[model samples]
Target: MNMKLFIFIVLISPLLASLSSFILKNKRFAEYISLLASSLDIIGAFIILYFVLNFKPIFLFNNAIAIDKFSAYLILLVSIVYFLSSIYSISYMRLAINNEKMTENEFFRYELFFNLFAFTMLIAPMINNMAVYLIDIELTTITSSFLVISEVTEKSIEAAWKYILVVSSGISLALLGTILFYLSGNIPGSANIVSSLDWTVLGLNAVYLNEGIVRIAFVLIVIGLGTKVGLAPMHTWVPDAYSEAPSPVSAMLSASLENVALYGIIRYFGIAGKSLGFGYPEVILITIGIFSIFIGVMGIIYQNSSKRLFAYSSIEHMGIITLGFGLGGIFGTFGALLQMLGHTLTKSTMYFGAGNFLHKFKTKNIKKIKGVFHIMPKTAFLFSIGSVALIGVPPSVIFISEFLIILQSLKDGYYLVAVILIGFLLAAFISLLTKSGSMVFGKADENFKAERGDFSPFSYVPMLLPLAASLILGFYIPNGLHNLLIGIVHIINFKIK
Candidate 1:
């Protein structure tokens, strides 16, 4: 099939599914439709990736939409999460409707927005225009905020509100920065030289951009998009939204959406680095990266809610990714990209496990949830292993990514940075394992006697697939994936030959 046709199908499938689902509202079949659509999306994304690797980048709509190796990889990541979330939703939404008194209307709305949310994220990376990309990111924020309120409680409502308000403000700042990017190229005699906000155009003409203005604009872009990416000081909305949204939605948000938002920051990082040299962008990313890691670890240390704990972990992981990109060598950049894949797989597994706990025990409080080894042995086992993997234990993809990042710091002679990075990694490892250990093995309450089994196969199976993939990849990255990562590293112009 023509790659453009595949791209069209990939972009339209979710919208068609969303509309059909709302019209049908057949509780019995709605989930299957969603699953089918998401599956198609995954196939399309993979095809695009395959084409990009074997051929050249695909462009359509007068260069308005471009799918290169980087974008293809992101599309695949988003689709993977969307596919898993849809499968898990079959089990999760059913339980929510029956046990939590969720209205059929709310359930229908959830299905509608769920697919729309995925659609927005799917398209964000495909847009060649940076401005349109930000607009698409804003659309994701809007659609997902509705998903946050799918349960319709006061706290969920509050989370949705905060999410919209904060993310919108951040996007506005990013718009200002984008306009500055246009103006940086539109100086008195240069008006006709640069005519589009497409990343390709700006990147090609980066040398013509006013360096002074590009510097300030790049900073604004980071701060603005960083809010959407859940970077620190701009991350207040993430915990609330993640904790309140349904588990499937939380998986999408943390596992896929943040990476989509960070995709914007990275594109700009490439542009700004090309224009103003790597020093400025690298320092900015490294500083924010380290600070965000600190905040996330601190949050993990004190978190009481299971969902919020993982939400904070998302922030920590994002911080690590940001730092990796900032470190800017072969190891650092490759490690960051690898971390993105590892995080998508591992974090989704953990959140799905958390969903099982919530469904089984009917609580999110860490102290109130206990004896998972006795209550739901499969979930407990998978969740426990997932937690270990998440904290960068050996033979997990995360361990490889984190190790590569640390190696980069040492190679660059940043001893203090290396120490701090290791310290934070150790802190996260100890804190996460300690809390998970208490929950998984803590004494079962005398009155708490639920069945000693997992939720439907949907729940634990989704968890198992990602965990297994992470472990296998840790031992050996397949040649195709290795080359894909190398292609991306080249795209980002990191020098580490």
Candidate 2:
């Protein structure tokens, strides 16, 4: 049980995948190698989770790397999406080669940046220094921007630029907030001064920090990280980027990358709450969370493109997660954390299904993508089931998570808040199902053209795996996961007080 060995396995696997893919430039080698790497990382992540559950938080490399239950949980989520996306990419990129006119160089580029993007996100939560963590997040932006333009279209280029410019600006603000956090502990004449930028140290000494600085810094952190989280007012980049990226990359972005960014924000939320009292930051998260959900549902209602429809759904889900955290109790916080897992499992299934539709119909427009059930029966069946789960239907983990959050709001006596939340949830539930149902059950055009069969098993297998996992979790939450989630709640709650 060498801790460092497992850490090395998790971090280095993706880096090696990125390097070998670019160096060798063989398509099949690149495809299978990426899959092999993700497989290894997934096993490593589970081991890390098991160790964290039974033992102590791990700090290695002179404390430059840290992994607590919270970090372990996030790592597991990222690895899950990484594994699924890699499998889906085999079918996805091959189709691009044969049908979408993708060059070998572009495919090579996709594999290179794809694994690197996962590597960056994998490292973000493990880093001890807040500033260094921000740098890693920025690296994800760079690698993912390349992935966004995998098809090299006008729309893809614009989406890449928009993704970079907007998210980079957000990261810059997060950096400033990190600097302010450092200064908060070193106020000019404080005898009990600590000048570390490591969040572990800052969080432990939050009570000694300057309250005024913590207040402003927390706001900046939320605004900054919220952009990456796809929160409203700062969520403009999300729709374009998610729509333009390949389905695998979109799953990584929506399912994994957003959770990584949010891990940073939640770290600060605890620190800021401890510094300035739980009340101040709770209001901020609650307010912004509500607004983001509003924006997300509106976008979903109006969305015509299949990918953009789900992009807005990401925003809505993130908002619910934030709102759950804002409510600040066991149910609220635990529900939010569970929602992260639920979202990751369900969303990847969705994007893979969407990828199938895109390949079959040769379009992103929902109107053009009708009668998926007619063309790709397996994909349409899974997509339809996934849509039901995505909308928080019963026998889905999302239903449990969202219901817990509502229960928290009611227990806290925020009646209006509960009502508003239920309203939006209802709106999103109806709107998304409508869009997906039309595509699944709608009539195919008289002159419908593409072949009437699903793509390779690679396309649909990934969908089935996660969909089944989500359904099982919904039916029965395992004792181990229940404890792990409770441990994560303690991780956040223990610091906030």
Candidate 3:
């Protein structure tokens, strides 16, 4: 098949699925359509990745759309989460309708927004124009915020409201930054650049951009997109949105959407590094990265809700990734990219487990839920292992990434930064394990008899797949993935020698 054909399918499948789902809202087959659409997207993502590795970056629409290794990898990540979330939704939405009094209309709306949400994220990484990419990120916010309110309680509505308002404000700031980027290009003594917002154009002409304007624009980009990426200080809406959204939506938001937003920051990082030198952007990334780690660990230490606990963990992991990119050596950049994959796998697994717990135990409170090992043995086992992996346990992909990051920090002679990184990692490890252990093994309330097994194969299987992959990749990264990460590192153009 022509690669553009696949790209078209990748971009169009979800819209078709969303429309089909809305029309077929009364039918039980809507979920199957969703799964099929996501399956097609997965195939398309692989095709794009394969072509990018073997051939060249795929371009369409006169360069308006482009898919390189970095973009392909992101598409694959988003598709993977979308596929799993679709499968898990089969059981999750059913339970919501049967047990939680969720109406059919609410379920239908959930499917509609769910497919649209995935669509927005899928197209984001493929856009060649940075401005358009940011617009797509904003669209993701709007679509996923509706998913946040799928069940429409007061809290869910509030979460959705906060999500839209904060992220919109952040995006507005990013727009100002983007305009500055254009202005930098159009300034005096600079040749008029028609496509200033195109990443390709900006990248090629980065040296010509006004230095002071570039600095200010980079900061605005980070702050604006950082809000969407769930970086702290801009992260207040994240916990609420993740906690209140349906588990499948929460999984996508944390596992895939944040990465999509972060992709924008990293792109700008590349531009800024090219224009203003790596040191300036590196320092900015590292400072925010460390502070986010602190805030996330603190939140995990005191969290009472299971969903919110993982939300904080997401922030911590994002911090780690940001720090890795900031460190800017082969090890640091490679570790950060690897951490992105590890996080997508492990965090999604953990969220799936949390979703199951919510369905089976009817609560998100950490204290109220107990003896998951007895209530749902398989989910408990997987969730426990996922928690360990999430905290960088040995033989998990996270461990490798964290280790690589620490090695880079030490190698760079940033002794204090290394110590702080390790301290935060240890803190997160202890706090997360303690919280998950309690939920898995704590005594069940005397009157809390419910079920004695997992929700469905759909629920636990998705958790197991990612957990197993993380474990295997920890021991060995396949050649294809290794090369893909290397390609991305090259694209980021950071080297220490």
Candidate 1, residue 372: Cα displacement in angstroms equals: 0.7
- Predicted candidate 2 versus true structure: per-residue lDDT over 58-177, tens digit per residue: 999888998999999999999999999999999999998999899999999999999999999999999999999999999999999999999999999999999999999999998898
In model 1, which residue pairs have backbone atoms overlapping below 3 Å? none
Question: Any runs in candidate 3 off by more than 4 Å, and if so which?
Answer: 189-195, 494-497
| Minimal lDDT window, size 10, model 3 | 187-196
If scored against the real structure, what TM-score would every candidate get?
A: 0.99, 0.99, 0.98
Alpha-carbon lDDT, every model: 0.93, 0.94, 0.92
lDDT of candidate 3 at residue 302, scale 0 to 100: 97
Residue 42, candidate 1: C-alpha displacement in angstroms: 1.0
Candidates ranked by lDDT, best first?
Answer: 2, 1, 3
Instruction: Order candidates by TM-score, high to low.
Output: 2, 1, 3
Go through the candidates in order and give the clash count of each.
0, 0, 0
Q: Tens digits of per-residue lDDT for model 3 on 1-497?
A: 48878888998999999999898665477889999999999998998899999889888899999788999999999999999999999989988988999988888899999999999999999999988898899999999999999998999999999999999999999999999998888886657553458887788778888889999999999999999999988999999999999999999999999899999999999999999999999999999999999999999999999999999999999999999999988899999999999999999999989999998888999999889998899999999999999999998999999999999999989889999999999999898999999999998787987757778788888899989999999999999999999989998874443
Give Cα distance to truth, residue 468, candidate 2, Å.
Answer: 0.3
Clashing pairs in 3: none
